[model samples]
Target chain A: MDIFGVPIQALMGQLMLGIVNGSFYAVLSLGLAIIFGVLKIVNFAHGAFFMLGAFTAFLLGQHLGANYWVALVAAPIAVALFGMLFEWLFLRRLYGLDPIYGLLLTFSLVLVLEGGFRVAFGSSGQPYATPEALRGTINLGFMVLPIYRGFVILAAVLTCLVTWYVIERTSVGARLRAATERAELTQAFGINVPLLVTLTYGVGVGLAAFAGVLAAPIFHVNPSMGSSLVIIIFAVVVIGGLGSIMGAIVTGLGLGVVEGFTRVFYSEFSSTIVFLVMVLVLLIRPAGLFGREES
Target chain B: MHLRSLTLPLSIVAVLALLAIPFFPQWIYLVFVMKTLCFVLFACAFNLLLGHTGILSFGHAAFFGSGAYIAGHLVKNYGVPFELGILAGGLVAALLGAVIGALAIRRSGIYLAMITLAMSQLVYFFYLQAPFTGAEDGLQRVPRGTFLGVIDLRNDTALYYVVLGIVAVGLWVVWRTVNSPFGQVLRAIREHEPRAISLGYPVARYKILVFTLSAGLSGIAGALKAIIFQLAALYDVHWHTSGDVILMTLLGGMNTVFGPAVGAAIVAALNHYLDPFGAWVTVITGVVFMACVLAFRQGVVGELGRLLKLRRPSRPEQTADQPARGESQP
Candidate 1:
């Protein structure tokens, strides 16, 4: 029952926890990659939208008596709509300028969202109850896993696959790819590249909201939660290669597991392991693990 | 046309006006001015990288906070002179800058920003876990120790003058650096990196050097702040501080030499006045950020410079580079 002088159950538990975290990373980074690909703007407000998703769910539950399932379906849609509006009104002007302006604009949005939420709800975290059906524990041969966590892993993986499917297989996805590659040409071909770009931004942030709702029960729902998570996701994107969709998903999951194991062995470094990995990756491969060199 | 001839007298008047701040107790608080001076130095140093070198480093808080923590730890525990502690802080931060800068400059634009941010997060985690930093409570009640073994800094008036002098010297260094021949090369690199590289300039080395100088100056600001407040806290190292510095530089006009100083004062004043609003301060700051990015990219000073026709119409870009760079002769 011991592996390398540590309990097998403890390792297994960390592994499961890591996988759940990986799922969130995978989903979040996928969104980042999508936005960066199509808009050529780094959506700094991605994390803000994530927080918005959780807050929307929390408020819906409180005011409208919406259930967990209702929130899971509605929060992302609402956030995506909000994101599309942001794209239409503000983010559109930033296109073709230095991407840093986009980052600064979104960073400002983060301040607004996080600060506003802190005002409405104190900085202290508010908890959301795990759904009744997924409240129990599951026993595996090596470890006992919380049913909610298992559900999280399952749900997150399914979300990633469906997102991948939509982006990779659909005709809409082909148009998106075409726009990302040659926006001017795509427009010449009668594709509304502008609308596609806006929708892509919406979809990207919607994915972040999806991860946020998924995280609500596992982590305390708080204003500042997504701020830090988004930074880590930025690292994940960097390590995986910016704008590389497959790279984002794979590196996110891999780094999460690496972080989980680091906790088991060198617990003090748990918070910093991903960043350290990023530093190492940059040193070895400046273009990132999956990114192509820019001309 | 004679505006450039007035630069010397204007600067002297400004300094003398600053010297008079300690005397005016009712109108302007000494502590507020001291804090603003710290940010002025900090923001100006940040612009060395941002405005001059065209590198957007998101991890500047690392240098600032580390400087604070290092100086605080040395002065409190080891009983080092305040000057030595400050120097040590700058040296350590510069060293950190060199390492971080070398790694970061390999990538440009957004990747560079993300790398610095991640590294700073790593530093943040270190401070959070390190025993010396006191985590949330921070390194508190640090002594304001003597300056060069004289000048009792425990007195607010004495400390204010010292802070003012140090900030003046710091700003002068920034001004000198920006106007130096080295600075022209930096501008050249910022304007076009590939061209600079092809022109035989060691682009990466220049970048790392500028990053080091900026970090070192920023470290001095952070260390002075710790000495002034007699505390080094977590917020100094937080990413929000990084964001705050960026806002200050951008809003003040990164291209203008005196812009960040003006920007820092304005932002510090905003924070001072908005403290009572609780979280609305952040909302307002964000609104300002949006406005600045969208409508005021030229910034307050930049717009003013434009309106004043600070430089010849033939050299539009140089207008912001140095408003007083020997262009006064008719």
Candidate 2:
């Protein structure tokens, strides 16, 4: 009934929580991996965009009296458009230069967004209630799972699968891959590579915002929330390897579960275990689990 | 218009300004200058890797914060002399840097930065949970401790001079490292790692050495900060501090010797003046970051050098042939 002196029920509960956390990690890092692949710049503002999504949802609910479903549908689209504007205006200029500048530019956006949110709202977190329909818990025989948490997992998985399918299967996806491999050559083939790049950034940021909406009800919606999570997601990106979409999802979920197990055994180290995994992965397989070794 | 011609005059002016600080109108200004000096050293150490070596380690605060913790514990609890405490902090940070750099140097560019950031997060978690760090409260009321056997650092004037002296020595080390043949090898590695390897240089080894040295020097700065404030708090090790150092380096002209120090002063002054504005400081700082990256990529000192038609002090040929080469808005 117990695994290592902890009860099965408790273990199952933690596992459920871990999967929920993993879902967010998957969605967020998937966005990161996609952005890196096409744009060739790590979007440091990805986390801030995630926070913006949550805030957008909150603001809509407050001012527009929008429901959960409505906010979810609208927030990402709005944030994505903003992201596209950012890409077209600023990020476009940094291409062909050192990638560090891209990172630096996006990082500044983080400061602005987080600071702006903090000033407009207080530094403390704002609470978002779970939707009316998904307020109750379901019994999984072994453990009781919150309906909202289950919904979150389902929604996140669906989003990831759809994104993966679009990027890896469709003809549009072919153009994307071609552009990523050889931008100039792809353009020579008569594609609007610049537009495609801008769209990719928008989609990537939109994905982050989508994850943010999902997280708003579960975690406190606050300015500093994404800053901390972004670092862990960076660990996830590293462990999974950069630019690998499948790798980002799998590693994120696996690390979440691993972190959950660590909590059961060594609760103090739950926050640090992912980083430890990163260090180990770097030692054994420097290219990352899913990444190709750079020339 | 040669930068070398201005170096002597600039150095003399800077020294005079530093010495005159103690005689400033207000006593509170000393605290500001001391803090700025600490950041100046921290930013310079950071530049050794970023500006000179072309390696971006985003998690640099791990070494800095650990150094503070180590030095603070030694001085406050173990009764070690301040000198030994500071050295111990630097050595420990160097060890940490070696371990991190050895793993991180395996990957180049963006990946390297992520690895360092992740490792520093791990370090941050440790400090957050560790008993010795006093959790969030930090190691407070740490004794200033006497310098040597008798200098009496308890006096604010005495402590300021000691801080200034140590920071000067630290800056000299950075200068020596950059001007030495070893520094040339670092530049070669930075410009092109593959070429450096083809030329039979141990590229990874050199990267690790610079990383270790940078971390050690940063540790000295952090240790000195702990002594000056008489406390070792969590923010010193936070990623925000790491980001601040990067900003200072970039805004001051990473390639120039004294650019980061000037950048540090500007940032410190901003923080001091903007203390009344609450969250606006973060917004302003962010604006500054954007402005620097977008328009002023060459930084304050680098821009000055360009305006005067003075060749870049470190490498005149690179500047003349390709102005703002990597940083140009292409």
Candidate 3:
């Protein structure tokens, strides 16, 4: 049962873990791509929103006695509403300005949000327990997988496909594309471009929150969690090509698997490997793997 | 209508205040000033890429931290002279800058920022895993070697003066670069890359040049801090260090030559006073960030320069290359 000096089971286990992690990466990067594509703004607070989603779930569970099931549905919705509200209140003003302003503004929100949480919860991280129903393990011939992880992978892949379908295949996606490409023209065609932009942003934020909720059981619910992962996600965005949907999904999953394998073989270099890949990608394709060169 | 300019006297007073810092009776406050001065150099280095070249680098701390690590490892382990160690630190950072700058400068705006951040985080991970870095404990009890093998930097006062000298020279170099033709071209490139190219400027070369210089100078700052404190820690190279430098430059003013130093001083002071609040400093810094972006985009010195220009109409775009990095100055 040995495969290249590592056990077959170990290899399979790592691969499964990698896919689960990849699913999270795929979902997160999709949200980033959507925001950057339509809004022309890099939502730096995406990670913060992710953390907030987890925290929102945490808070709901604690205060309102909502279970994990309730949180799984409500957290992303709550975050989406918050995201839409912010888009209306603040991000709306930054539309015509340099995208850097949007970056700075959202960057500040990260600080504020993380700082607030740190003050309230302290930085040590609170854990959410796995629900009793999904607490078992599934054994394949090569490996034994945690049921929760399998579910996560399945959920995440489905979400990614659905998101891609909606954005790339649906009429609403067409409208969304048209609005971003030519807002005034879309407006002339009787489309609510402004409202569409807001909705797109909400959906984007909701995706990040959904990822966050999924992560709550896997990782500790901590203030620094979002900030930490966000940097890696940024790398994923860069490697995949900014605003490229499929690029984001593919690169996220690929890098996550690469990272997971790196963890198994040469564990010490796991984190740095993604960045090295980014550096290599940039050197080879300055426009990114899927990004078109801007005029 | 005929008010005499007070710039000369103001500068002299500021210089005098700086010169008088070590003379202060309280060692704690003087240490604080020492730390502030180091960050001043670091922030100014960062601002060279940011304000002058119009690059929003989120990972300049890699250079700074690398410099510290290199210097600390050399001096603490190999017993290299502090002067040579410092030079070595800057050289290493410069080399790193050349590589990172070359890659990062290829992309513009947000992409460039993210690239720098990723690379720096990579560096952090390297340090975390690298045994020589002394990761958890860092390179501790680094020896304070002599300057030129003559001046003993072991004493706090001697170290302070040396640091001040290094910072003075560093600031002067940045100031010189900012007002130089190269600096102007960088500003031009920052303001508008397409136009700069149309004008036959090798925009990327200029960016890499400034990026390298800034990174080298930032490395020197980190090296100096390691020397003064006799410690080189992981915290020195963290993204927070990069953010701190950015915060300093933003708060002080992005457009002005003296802005980052001024911003660094203010932030360091505030950090000292607000030390009891623990993480509130980050929150406050974020508040300042929002405030500056929203209403006070010009920053403190930018505002001051505007006030000084009260006799003339404000050139809003001239003071900052806002709305985007390296997009349009003309």
What's the TM-score of every candidate structure? 0.96, 0.97, 0.95
Candidate 3 error regions (>4 Å): B1-4, B311-330
Task: Pull out the clashing pairs in model 1.
Answer: none
Q: What is the TM-score of chain A alone in each candidate?
A: 0.98, 0.99, 0.98
Residue B58 in model 1: lDDT = 93
lDDT tens digits, residues B175-239, model 3? 88887788889888877789999999988888888889999999999988887778888888888
CA displacement after TM-score superposition, residue B330 of candidate 1 (Å): 19
Candidate topping lDDT: 2
lDDT of 2 at B297: 83
Question: To one decimal place, how large is model 3's interface RMSD in Å?
Answer: 0.9
For A1-295, candidate 3 gives per-residue lDDT tens digits of 8877999888888888888888888999999999888888889899999999999999999999999889989999999999999889888888888787888888888888898889889999899987788899978767898999988998898999999999889999989888867888999999988889899999999999999999999999999889878899989988888757888999989998998898889887877788988989998998888888744
Q: State in Å the error of residue B125, model 2.
A: 0.6
What is candidate 3's local distance difference test score? Answer: 0.85
Q: In CAPRI terms, where does candidate 1 land? A: high
Candidate 2 interface RMSD, angstroms, 1 decimal: 0.7
Better of 1 and 3 by TM-score: 1
RMSD of each: 2.5, 2.6, 2.9
> What is the TM-score (0 to 1) of candidate 2?
0.97
lDDT, residue B85, candidate 3: 94
Tens-digit lDDT track of model 1 for A190-285: 999888988899899999998889899988899998999989998998888875778888898898899889989989988999999988988899
